[model samples]
Target: MTISAEEAARRPLVSDEQIEDRVADLIGRAIKRKWWILFLDENGVQLPMIVPVDGAPLVPDEAATEHSIEGLRVIMDEIGAAEVILVWERPTGSTVTLPDRVWASSMARAARDRGIRVRAQLISHRTGVRWFAPDDYEGHLEAS
Candidate 1:
């Protein structure tokens, strides 16, 4: 079951925990591998639009990552978004893998390069949702 845009817009995803819970509710327990972007207003309230990048590679390609981020930037600007929260959804275990780190780093770098602020990075797996801390992608930054 999916949530209505109105309901999503009413919620303020200000904290990491709120973002994680909202993402978990959005994707649910069963899901395919994909990337989800939760757009937030300047006040940290969620926007009605949630962008999903389907069929993305676990180990993202540099060019593709940049292109995707550029597209997202356009959308953000059009919608007056102030920030975005990235969610990596996959039907796997909760353990953070190398590919996860790479994806997180790539997404973060691409967004940063485009002058987009990322509120938080998260991963939703079989067990639950978990945050991608700075440490999670520090080493993978160079590789990305």
Candidate 2:
């Protein structure tokens, strides 16, 4: 259900300390899950090598095109990765927005093309927490 602005405002505010603890906990969980973290470069055309969850920060590229499946596909191919896990970073307390359905499709296509696997996760930078992918988000949210 869509919540009105007033209703959203009525929710309790989260404190910075809470956010930090949450983020740390989420990262710990991700590590336990054995999921590697990667950061998209400024061009959004490239990605750093995957690292352990505790290795380093996984910052999302702000300069990346909103629709960058093709670029991601190329990276996936070049790396010959067995699996691709997308990490989306959003400001604290903000709702998570899933990637374009096309993005997910493209990831799947890349996996098929390379005989690999693909997955994704959302990270709230503000709360330093990770959230489950949106349950109701359907195919590419953005128009191609």
Candidate 3:
């Protein structure tokens, strides 16, 4: 089933602040583990590029204007075989809304085209709180 951003905003769940906290905690964990963290602007250009998983902002605090597939594809082309592209997806409002299956599939295909393995994850505010596989937009994340 398709869930628009508007629909997700109205759902009963954790407050936006709590979601941010969760996301931050997740990002911190990834960084502490020394995994690679990537930050992308709305246009899909890497702001700081992929850095050592240090405590850093994987996603900016400001709202994203958009996450275009074209931009993602471009970034994917530059990825190396030994690298993993962690696509940080910011949740819309208080909910996480990923692109539809077709868009996601295309995004995944773009990464594979360059032999780069990509992982779609949610990250924003006070870090990466959750990790998701390429095709794992299962549903809205509920509050813990």
Candidate 4:
């Protein structure tokens, strides 16, 4: 169920449900761990420059996350993206875990620190893509 970036960009991803469905289609049963960055236009339409961060850790490390955030800022600025949606794709079960919470928390904090607007933080597991509920990441928001 994979789709090209051009095709994906043509679709409006304004809602969490739309984002989840599109991410699920793009990821299509992940075979490895990765982080995907979806930059959106001011109207919430996705841009064609989808970035897949290969070799991301199952449990993201602080240094790597910081570096990635810096990179994201540069890319967003270059393309004048209004917002970003992050998707952590992993070849694991669908049930949310501590690592998932931590990842979401870390990304939220990093984006906030950089003044980057994150539309959503999602997880694409073996089963499908889903948003990270506030409760899933609230506790870990201040962690580290």
**Cα lDDT tens digits for candidate 4, 57-114:** 7787899779888999999999999999888788898788888888788878888888
Instruction: Name every residue pair that clashes in candidate 4.
Output: none
Report how far residue 24 has shifted in candidate 2, in Å: 5.5
Which candidate tops TM-score? Answer: 1
Rank list by lDDT? 1, 4, 2, 3
TM-score of each: 0.89, 0.40, 0.33, 0.87
- For candidate 3, what is the lDDT? 0.38
Model 2, span 104-124: residue lDDT tens:
344444445655444444444
lDDT by residue for model 3 over 12-66, one digit each (tens)? 2224343334335334433222233454333333333444433323332212212
Report how far off residue 29 is in candidate 3 (Å): 13
Cα deviation at 131, candidate 4, in Å, is 1.9
Against the true structure, candidate 2 reaches a TM-score of 0.40
What residue pairs are clashing in model 2? 23-128, 92-126, 101-140, 101-141, 102-140
lDDT, candidate 1, 24-117, per-residue tens: 7887563788888888999888898888888777687888788888888999999999998888888899888888888788878877777899
Model 3 off-target regions past 4 Å?
1-81, 91-95, 100-104, 123-128, 137-144
Please list the C-alpha lDDT of all candidates, in the order they appear.
0.82, 0.40, 0.38, 0.82
Question: Cα lDDT for residue 74, model 2?
Answer: 64
TM-score of 4: 0.87
Poorest 10 consecutive residues by lDDT, candidate 3: 59-68
